[model samples]
Target: MFASSRKSSLFSSLFQTPHIICRGSSRNRVISGSDIAASSKVSAQWTRLGLSEKKPQEQKPAYATSDQRMASLSELKEIFRKADAVCFDVDSTVIKEEGIDELAKFCGVGDAVAEMTRRAMGGSLTFRAALTERLALIRPTREQVQALITEHPPRLTEGIKELVHKLHQRNIQVFLISGGFHSIVEHVATQLDIPLTNIYANRLKFYFNGEYAGFDETQLTAESGGKGKVIGLLKEKYGFRKIVMVGDGATDMEACPPADGFIGFGGNVTRQQVKEKAKWYITDFEELLRELDSDSIKMNHNDIFY
Candidate 1:
């Protein structure tokens, strides 16, 4: 009976697929293409998404040759020019590194977090446990985040500064909408001359002495579909006529119902689904800059009161 039981358990373990594991991260560091291909391929619930453009060569579509380039730049340019408010995703979209992951590396908890990530992926740990445990392991102090910024500033994507500047010049309101921590996103906003008030991201709470307490779970960005909710609030509060969201993720694309358009950016990193769905996809900000007219003035972003 003991031998039979062992054999049965082995068989079950080999065949069972578990769901509690961490298949997706907010930063999207895990889930590779080979893994995706091995997965059912029936639906893309937890696959074909990437933090970088390192997708399976087999999955890459035949290159489009509309001017031998990005097909919908014209449409994107139109939407961009007409937009009242333009929101950007921060981590991989505006900056090259993923903020939370960078914080982990800085806090000397990179290995621990990575192990938790592996466990989360392998179904040995629950997603909730993975997230909280990783946070606990990193417990990034207030000073750490600041020091991370000061010591090793996040790299901005090429042409992003120019893009934001031109949008501001055109009187198009630019806001940083991210699921990343406010501390990191704030730094990026400052570099771009974007106001702190214009940032919609998760906030980290701290003790009066500035020790890490926890992130504010109440923030709209702390939940799933939060970006969309924030865009809804942007419309209600600011009454924007036409808004555009630009980013490199599925969540960013999903925000387009609330937004007038979604522009896919692959300069820093490319995700498969984003490329396939984004009406206008570009790898460089110069593309948008080239499209933006110098004599632009339709809506005045400054006219709106904070």
Candidate 2:
């Protein structure tokens, strides 16, 4: 189980406006007061596509069950010991809430949107169809979008910050790749101290009057197997010998052949297909840290960093 204290720490860090410090650079870097003000203004203007409201309680789907979906922690630890990079799916894997679903709720179409999301994630519906349908239903306004950011910010998954920090210390490049919208994902990447350039997701377009228009059709993540394609590109560009994908959806599982490993995360929502297919599955991120600390898995720092 995820500890309450860890969740608290993650929430605290995520909501605060970051004052990024540049390390190992001769030019001392500090986020200027003006810059912070500008960021806050932009966040205020284009945050999320929802109004502030109590999130409806999410019911676990009947499909989720207690099954042996993971290898022994030791086995997983050994498998990932040499990973040079890690890619994470944002929505349910790294955050406790689904951004689009929340937006739909704010638009008073929660049930409809939730059903489509469930189908899409379960591999019953194509991601492109689901996204297109849901976006049309919501038709979120500019003000509503910004309110979603300010009023109902996405909550971080338990122990994710610690996991990311540890991976960074080990020189593993952490990337957040999602089928979600870039408007929200960009903020998440910034909060986690992940470079914006490393983040990949769909981008939404708004009319000059701030009305919802549509999304960029050209983004690779707009269709099925997009996550896998992104992973393939990363491998080609970085020449990473070993890469891992951590997510809670079938889309994440699609990255397996390109990614050396796939770890299913079910802390928020569990999908039966992902649980069954993943080589390892965990409900708590702390389990990963514990496995990484095991002595049986020798850390080859050189192989991972260089």
Best-performing candidate as measured by lDDT = 2
Error of 1 at 154 (Å): 1.6
Q: What are the per-residue Cα lDDT tens digits for candidate 1 across 257-289?
A: 677678988987778889988888889888778
TM-score to native of every candidate shown: 0.67, 0.71
What would the per-residue lDDT of candidate 2 be over residues 203-299, giving only the tens digit for each residue? 7766767777777667789988899888878877877767788999888987776676789999999888889877788898998887665532444
| Candidate 2 worst ten-residue window by lDDT | 1-10
| Per-residue lDDT of 109 in model 2 | 93
RMSD of each: 19.0, 20.6
- The Cα error of candidate 1 at residue 250, in Å, is 1.1
Whole-structure CA lDDT of model 1: 0.72
Candidate 2 accuracy as lDDT: 0.75
Query: Model 2: number of clashes?
Result: 3
lDDT of all the models against the reference? 0.72, 0.75
Q: Which residue pairs show collisions in model 2?
A: 48-145, 48-149, 49-145
